[model samples]
Target: MGHVFRTEQQALALDSLSRFLKAEVEPLYWHDYRDTFVPKEKLLPVTQQLAEFGLVSGVVSEEYGGLGADWLTNAMLFEEVAFTSCDLALLVLINSFGAYMLEKLASEALLERYLPGLVNGSRFVSIAISEPDVGSNVVEIKARARSTGENYVLSGEKTWISNGAYSDVLICTCRTSDEPRGGLTHFLLDRSEHPYEVQNIKKVALNSQSTAQVFLPEIVVPAHNMLGEKGEGLRNTLALFERSRVFVALCAVGIARRALHEAVHYAQERVQRGKKIAGHQLISAMLAEMATQVDAARLLCYRAAQMIEADLSAEMEAAMAKYFACEAAVKVTRQAVQIHGGNGVTTDFMVEKLAREALILPIPEGTSQIQQLIIGRALTGVNAL
Candidate 1:
């Protein structure tokens, strides 16, 4: 029912995307992505195809190559794509993520230099914000950049960066001073400069996508590379974060829906005690709960997205959406696994992969605990952490 509030154009766009993903993309994701990343050779062709169709920034002005669509349209597209492949969904979103920020904060010359390639899928982008010691605490980031008249020298490390290993341009956060607030600056760095090292990490889940640690030691970027006003990186990033968490919530909603659908399909056919398992009261109750939670999560994500489109403050709304949707996904996927019995853990069933992917949804953008802290502060006007 995500289409409940959508316009006719929005409905048509989402419908078109859904048919394309299911017909052309889902098989590749389910098959090629079983053991490893959908190979770059296999993934890029499809990604470039979608970029030509306007998956970049649907909310931006048409002059910037965006469709002048709404945020809800973009979120709907991503959510539907996530139902097919969370890995591809992530790449789709992150492709334009750093580029959109550049569009917002980069100098006109810089944007002219990079935005087209970024928007059209020729250039790869990554956002470097978290450090080994710092996740949600932006004020404690240890990466440092110092102005050197012509350029700024950067030194620090970032971990858990998606696309870090392959980024052409990286938007990196650095400490410009020792102050807890207003000391941070974001620098747009060219990774080909050889100022940093990236090592792709191996993880138990989401292995079909890239995750890496980035090390920057004395890397220098042009003075104009600073994004947004100096000393305002945290504020800018927080603004981005509020919206990003909602997209992450969409990922959860997608996974939850897919998992719920799979469970229902399985229950209808699997027989136990001379009857289909779906006919059993306890099994039916689990299915009922899963369906209810997935829709609820979807509603929460759409509510947060609508607030973002309205240009309203959504810090608390985003936190609520992220926390509820991700937890809902985890619960739904767990039930799916239980319903599938031993088949759930095997590679033979897609539910196994869905379960692993679901486990990852609550960690990024902000941990559920961090979201709770944000919501708590909003409600009580006191910092709990």
Candidate 2:
């Protein structure tokens, strides 16, 4: 609940990342890949660059090829990444959390096998949880991994899987039992070894990133590929969600902040009634509201991040931050578009893209409705979901 200021190391790292973005990634993103899917070949280099700053697989310990930064520091770096490119931010997020889970749950040999490529960004990873039928209700997952002799036959369809098409490894959630919450388990599936199918799913925004349908059709996975205990998937996943939701909230904040910047820049340059629109009372008021909302949302995200770094259970706080920030992004980006007037809808400007990107924020992590239900459960001690 206390305010968390950035440490000197985090500040320097942020500065370095900002410089790198402006100098290298920004030009590349705008020049060739803003409106289309960024190829894995192009993305891997940037991922490796990010790894140098301890961001690609951040939050894992230094002993296992990570920076060992705290959650708040990682959140700070993550927001900066999102500001430059939300698409890349999502990729970094998947890699970071995927590595986090690997470090926390994988056996020593498993970690030894995967951690090197992941840390260096030579390999891409994804966490497959959502399915064709399952959304917020994780217990309803039908993806099953039937045990056999020293191997499990995995069969399931995981949809809305980020990095699915590009992933070399997947941390897939599967149903290993029929005991509701305890039935879910996670499996580490190597694409070369297990051979699952993937098809990219096109979307309204953030197309520079891959969102795909992953089909695991009776893939043979060795028993060693099982992540954690058989029934501990839900608990580990929920724990990851507490921290991951905060990072998602920060992504929303970054988008809104960029939108605000665009609006302010446009308002000051555009003339209306012989004066800059920024001087007009209405435009000024709208800018004020957008700025205020962005700041408030960012503060909420940081609060949740701080709580997570302090080793606290941030379920309710994470839900609150994710709910408020994502909703605020929708509002803030729309206002940015309104400020841009007729030009807002055109592809010539970046505000339109920001608006489109913001639209996707409220749905990921959890829907705004889901976050509200989580807060409701926290406050009333009643399970709303």
Candidate 3:
């Protein structure tokens, strides 16, 4: 059981959050809006509410108006959120990580300007890394940032950026030099000060969140806006990924858990051949498998979270969690649909949306394939990519 890993405080926090989400957030996501983006205006109210429990200002220390909850606690919170609404969970995730980045790397002035709003959820933030030609390969990033005296003139495009359309601040990865390893740099761009363009990309699922292409054509960012040391973006980003991949895995676990619940509930109620489908051997077997997979995925995610909390290197464990959990989500959700029979493919059922949402989990954070390579590289001590 997940309770095996969580502390009493963490369990209590998750319980409170579970009730809050059910009463306050679930209606907005499931009853009012489905298969469409909740406008930023509506979403902000929920995010602000989440900040009360430290979901928004994640990893930022309490001195900065953040809860400074441990990563394991945060993982539990987000997993609960994803169970209620994966789309909303993602919006919270990007803000949380953005706040963490600012707390960790931003200059005092940069922190003063952005951290408050990000902590309170009034401002949204995004990390821009993937280019049209680059995914999972940070060294090959093509977005260019040229020094111009006191400022850096940035010009490039970033695709598949979550929160791109709504970001108040963007931690963008840019190629500042020609060298492969040290070329990459991180710049903190305020949307109001350094304007850029965004075009929202439509997708198969998670439509309630923004996934967009960000275009920066010679946007001038002050040198002070640079995050961390220059030429250290790749190293910094990789460090973040070691933990982030675990959170992403938890999201997949949440989706699978929901699908499993839906299938079990449906089987108990639906009758086939003069008996409840839950009584049928094949349906029962599917239910058993779904429960096992969901718990297994949850264990892996919690293990990775524990490692991160202990400040251990979880590069290999994180990759394993992400790869296993995301694939489990796809499999479990498909099985949920099959258990629902004809109704599963229809919009009237939540399983349909769960299935669509599950499909997107393996793509972001890192593709399932990329996660496998990371795991393989860890095992063999050889770089496959």
Candidate 4:
């Protein structure tokens, strides 16, 4: 039963999610209103609908009002959403990540206060870690949190924060002490009551998602809002990375698959030299390579998901999956553009959007270079970064 259960249940769940995406999301892909930065009104209805299906909190524990599905199931759901819109997928993904951390590390009182609204999609959350001077270097952040008797005063700036403008709560990392790696701490900030401000940033891609520069000026968080134990934020953040990398890899897989699918469809329909472009060996070779890489990325992503579900040490595996999937997605998107020729560069052709979105995958979650360093350190027992 375990063998059959694994095979059939997983397939059935994926099939259902794929159908949902086709019915609800695919039709909206070409809508004139779809943008990288999803507006609050537009995002609220969609998120509410997804909440009815328990998607927003699928990874959280069932006791906390989530589906409590395994990591592979969540990965499949992420892939399906990406096939529809990467921006929407991100909107949901960031919320899920914040909720997962709160469930795992926050005090029970904190969980009771936040998890319900988060799971029901009534509230949005985002992580604020990247700073103007520190994009991927968590240890070097200058954001400081000073204890002031009854509360902590947080002062600093965070740039490139996803969902920054719209999020109701922010799980932010700040330096609390001067213990180098151990000095960092995580705080749950209620943006509504805080003196923080968000300024949207324009970008070359991912224009539909809200990426912003966040400013905090003596924002006071209750002492109870500290996640985990004081001085343990760095360690907790590292643990969160294991799960975050898997989701990022899944996003890469979805983006790559969609790009390849569009390119193949174009090749089969467009006639060049009195035959379909797909019939030409050059085009066929490109499509073939793209298909192979997409499959490889999917397998690696699933393997990493499985490792996370099995309670194994997946740091190296997660890094490898994210690195390979993101790089492969970039390659696939570039080839997709080549296959479509001039049409690929225009907004009318979806491949252009895919290409733009693919460019950002390597830089988010963790950069491909950072992934390489993680894997290097894992294999060589030497801290290369």
- Measured over all alpha carbons after superposition, the RMSD of each candidate to the real structure, in angstroms, is 1.6, 1.9, 1.2, 2.6
TM-score of 2: 0.97
**Candidate 2's residue-wise lDDT over 1-385, tens digit each?**
1244767887899999999987878776766888798888888889899999878667889899787887778888899988888888888889888988999999999999998898888888989999999988888999999999799999989999998888999999999999999999999999999999999999999888999999998999999899999999999999999988888898898899889989999999999899999999999999999999988888888888888888888899999999999999999999999999999999888889988899998887789999999999999999878
- Tens-digit lDDT track of model 4 for 230-270: 88888888898988987888788888889998998999999
TM-scores of all candidate predictions against the true structure: 0.96, 0.97, 0.98, 0.95
**Per-residue lDDT of 34-130 in model 3, one digit per residue for the tens?**
8787888998888888888768765789888788888888888889999999888888888888888888899898888899999987899999999
Please, what are the lDDT tens digits per residue for candidate 1 over residues 123-239?
777888999999978799999998899899999899998877657888898998898889988898877774578888887677777788999978978888889988998998988
lDDT of each: 0.84, 0.89, 0.89, 0.85
Identify the leading candidate in terms of lDDT.
2
Model 3 is weakest, by summed lDDT over 10 consecutive residues, at 1-10
* lDDT at residue 208 of model 3 (Cα atoms): 80
Off by over 4 Å in 1: 1-3
RMSD of 2: 1.9
